[model samples]
Target chain A: MTGGRLAVRKTYKLFIGGAFPRSESGRTLELEGYNVARASRKDAREAVVAARKAFGGWSAATAYNRGQVLYRLAETMETRAGAFAAACTGRREVARAIDRVVWYAGWADKLAQVLGSANPVAGPYFNFTIPEPTGVVAIIAPTEPALDGLVARLAPAVVGGNAVIILASDDHPLAAIELAEAVATSDVPGGVVNVLTGLRSELAPVLAAHMDVNAIDVTGADGDVAALEVLAAENVKRVVRAREDRSPWEIASFMELKTVWHPIGR
Target chain B: MTDLQKRGDRSPVPTDWTYAPAPESTDIVRLQERYGLYVGGEWLETKDQFTTIAPRDESPLAEVGQASEADVQNAVAAAREAFKSWSKLPATERAKYLFRIARILAERSREFAVLESLNGGKPIKESRDVDLPLAAAHFFYYAGWADKLEYAYPNRSPKPLGVAGQIIPWNFPLLMLAWKIAPALACGNTVVLKPAETTPLTALLFADVCRQAEVPPGVVNIVTGDGSTGAHLVRSEGIGKVAFTGSTEVGKAIQRELAGRDISLTLELGGKAANIVFEDCALDQAVEGIVNGIYFNQGHVCCAGSRLLVQESIHDQLVRKLKRRMSTLRVGDPLDKNTDVGAINSKAQLDRITELVQAGTDEGAELYQPPCRLPEKGWWFAPTVFTNVAQSHRIAQEEIFGPVLSVLTFRTPDEAVEKANNTMYGLSAGIWTEKGSRILWMADRLRAGVVWGNTFNRFDPASPFGGYKESGFGREGGRHGLEAYLRFE
Candidate 1:
């Protein structure tokens, strides 16, 4: 190691179609005084294409399997907490990030319980209710607390089995790229989570109004909330408004409900 | 014959200056106090009655049965009673009813359009074309969801809310009805519907259509009246859920009334949607969106793009194009074939529009109007636009609900998004851009419920639509639309 600092390795790239590559537009931006990867509009479109390819199978995953995968992700994230924390600007954020992963992992099984309930419906046929995830969520990670907030926002969505296209915060994106590496090495299937780091003013609307993005999370978005809300409406994507005081446990807010109805036949 | 006698002999002086179309015996659905509130397969009546008027000339159209507090209670009771069986029906069977309703509406399209125009004061072309077709498509689209609720709410049973009390607005009477009723019915909930008092004709006609479609009685009840009637329906102890589409003021009132009640409510209220035109946008397309945004349906649209935010670089050129396009808009009798804008829905509404337009001028925003004539007897307001409008002006902030546009300009993309989102309402917005990157970027920042790119006010049944923030909550279309009518268990 040079000067007692860990020898840095690997240049992060855009995650698309189960492979990592420099953006098709061949664009890169300087982050933290280093030439880090930046995604192009084409790369964003490719992420969408990959998300579309993965949506059906991923969304079709059984709740139990989804729960298991989420749990596994939490386990993997726990082991790599030091790396994630080191990537972030501080240590408090890393702890919160790990806590967020655990919190969301637990919700994989419990969300259906909270958002779904047995309907005391009027008719004789047995009726029950559940919540379902809106597919292929496109997330604009909160600009601050790049790693923890992003993890908190994205974990619940994926725990609920939503494929995601996350546009990492433009200013501090290394953490996001690192998080993507963590996801890649984990058992999480490719295309289930895509990370694009670029100017949000450049990529958000594409994700928001994208015909394919089923929902969007602007939890970290600061300004122009109304414009993003409107753009997501083009395809009627379910939008999660940004919350300034959101905590790690709040990840459960993104979980989809699924209600199951079984007849009480004698 | 003498000269005077010859003049009299000339077609007897065409006695009735107003055009009179033949009245159809089959189409008339009589309004009466004893009319059964259609709920759960039964017709029940309330003790009260309210008069519905023709906005065309402010004449009494009919005395519609007002839902009593008890009537609301009874209707909700029936709906709740029916929800078990109805909600249990396979999504496919539920969709069949919606599909049938869509077909029936289409088959009776002409009759519905005429009655809609007569009741709501919208132009015949709009009623016949935009409103009716979209209404039919809404039902048809939701009908597909009857079986697909599984897919819609995957891994979960999407149960129906027991009883939904839906109130529709007068602007797009039939279409609003479809927006509320189609989704509710498809989601397998019984509904007590209150059509805006001024526009009850098409809804009553719809009841008849429901009867024809063999939609079991009590599944959908039509209670026609004014705010009092709507308020009573909303406050009734029986309703499990409430959905209202109208002015934001009234939406807040409904919310207040239901505040302590154990009911889920969705309000599709007002919007001052911003239609932003960038310097590089296709000028002709942006101009078309501008006209559609403000002039469509005489600007009574809640999500109408009333605030025109153009880039400063293209402001002059865009305004010139907009003015030229406005000149071509034909404003006249709703019955006329060439009319683009129709009469204001009612006298009160017209007065409000006129008052706001005057305020725009009084505030020093320069007003421009295309040369157009207004009908003397009915409520009418010419298509109007105000330039040099400050972002802080009342005219720019408030929803005028008439064919009025407020013009403001911004210099940068950040400024455009800032100006576009500076509103209490977040219903819908429009962005005109040829650059694909910018389109996506801008869309992500807008907080409105829907964003139209390259087009304005283009609504489809397959797409979900609704507002964010005070523009109201809950969506009205698509798979996402089902959530409004369904319950999560």
Candidate 2:
């Protein structure tokens, strides 16, 4: 060793269908002192296809199973808190992110009771309404407090059984890819959570316009939310902005209420 | 092949069992010669006007004002001005106005029912039994919620969203108005409502009901016109939210126009629902449900079960029974109490249905129209059932919005779910099965907003009603309906 101990740098890549793969475009952008994969529009489209393919089983899974998977996500992150603190944000943010995941995990089984209702409808029918996932939701992760903000959006969405394809913060993309790594090991079935990193301008519009995408969380969208919402309207997508407060309503934003009616007969 | 064999060899409906005309009297409704825009609790005259006609015989009922851009501006200003006091009123005070409106509606139910039939072309049986009562019930329902706003959305303070711009379809004019106005007013939001061009009379009459209930001036405004008027109202400034119940095309346009803006929107759009009848279903009860599912309101309902997906094994028996039952339906005057199906809403809608039915025939599906004599005076379409319909058939995919049913068969429940949900619309679906477990299982799989088991085309104010996917979003009934009008703090 001529001067110092050898240091091996980590390779940052795109996560699709639970696998870390180089951007299909084989593109990379130099950020700070590292090279990060720059996802292409085609990459965003593929992520949507992956998410849609996984939606059935992921959404159909019992809420308790989803809750356990999400809680395991917290456990996985807790073990990697030091790495996330070094790679993304401070230790406090990492701990909060893990705690936030555990918080949403508890909501997985209780969302129906809180959001659903057994109506006293004026009829000879038993009528009730329950919340169901809005299917494949695309999120734009916030730049600051990257891990905390990303988990804030991702946990609520997946807790409601939605398969997600998130666009990580361009400047803070490492934490998201790292979170995807955690997701892969957290028993969140493959493709249920796909992470794409690239120029927000390049990837946000593609995800916004994807027909298979049912709802979009524009919380971290850079000044282009108006444009993104316009594109989202092409498929009548549910457009939601960042909620100022953390609550179950945030989860409800990504869900569709389904009402069922049955004849009350002897 | 003989006509009988072509029709699946159904026995003829006995002519001797004809219903003698038991017509409801039209004298109860007193329509004004000319109606003006109801803005700020007063009738304001406008130069532009259109005649709303009784679709039963093409008779002119009243002259309705065509709200111009300037008129819409006045309505919005009125609603905005009203919102100041209306939103600030004691919640209990607000509740009383709605209770009064509901009471007034029930008191004058007959008049509204006759006018709804005369102006909207739905049967008196429906307007009296279903539409009028439901309309009043919506008011009664939301009235109770006015003071309970704190409990509706947990951990959030609910506040009114100022003025709401609501555009309702002609199919269920008065009821749609109630659906739009009640919760809105209950949530403390003033509304600027535009009734469909063909059916503006009932809404104008509702304006009088508001006055009778002593609702605050400018709290409720009625702007009557066609699509242009609705467009103007939608684009008008001072509207905090837009609630539209119409075709998906218009709903999409509204969405695009509101894009990049801060206004909230909810659309209740079109649907081509599947009414699946399983082999294990009670055949006769399923037959009645099938008929009611498609023929209700002349199939003008957005959630109409226009596509019948029958289990392959029971297809023949169900079709035969459905055909025989359809033959007994009396398609006649909307004012006739015995009329099972009323006149089509308008000539334009009738043409749309005719064109789609022709497409079904051209695409190699067998069409069955019961031998009922359609009246010559106004637009009418015979209750139609198309069998041997392919999943790809236009009639199976499109919302005919008339008395039409397209029948297709499925061998398995998985195939039934696949075929039922293949469409772009997911407003509602019907499952006919005596098996309880299968009903719940199928209900979980059908990608629809509303699922009706062993029954169809049912509605209640306490029950949430809306769609999934392209049929549009935001529920219009029940506690869930409150979300659209209130902004959480």
Backbone clashes per model, in order?
43, 0
Q: Put down candidate 1 lDDT per residue, B203-296, tens digits, no spaces.
A: 8778788888888767887877678778888877767789999887787667656633447777788999998888998789779889998999
Q: TM-score, B chain, candidate 2? A: 0.96
Give the candidate number with the greatest TM-score.
Answer: 2
Top-DockQ structure, candidate number: 2
**Which 10 residues in a row give candidate 1 chain B its minimum summed lDDT?**
B18-27
**Model 1 spans with C-alpha error above 4 angstroms:** A1-266, B1-46, B260-262
Docking class of 2: medium
Q: What residue runs in model 2 are displaced by over 4 Å at the alpha carbon?
A: A1-3, B1-17
The global C-alpha lDDT for each of the candidates, from Candidate 1 onward, is 0.75, 0.92
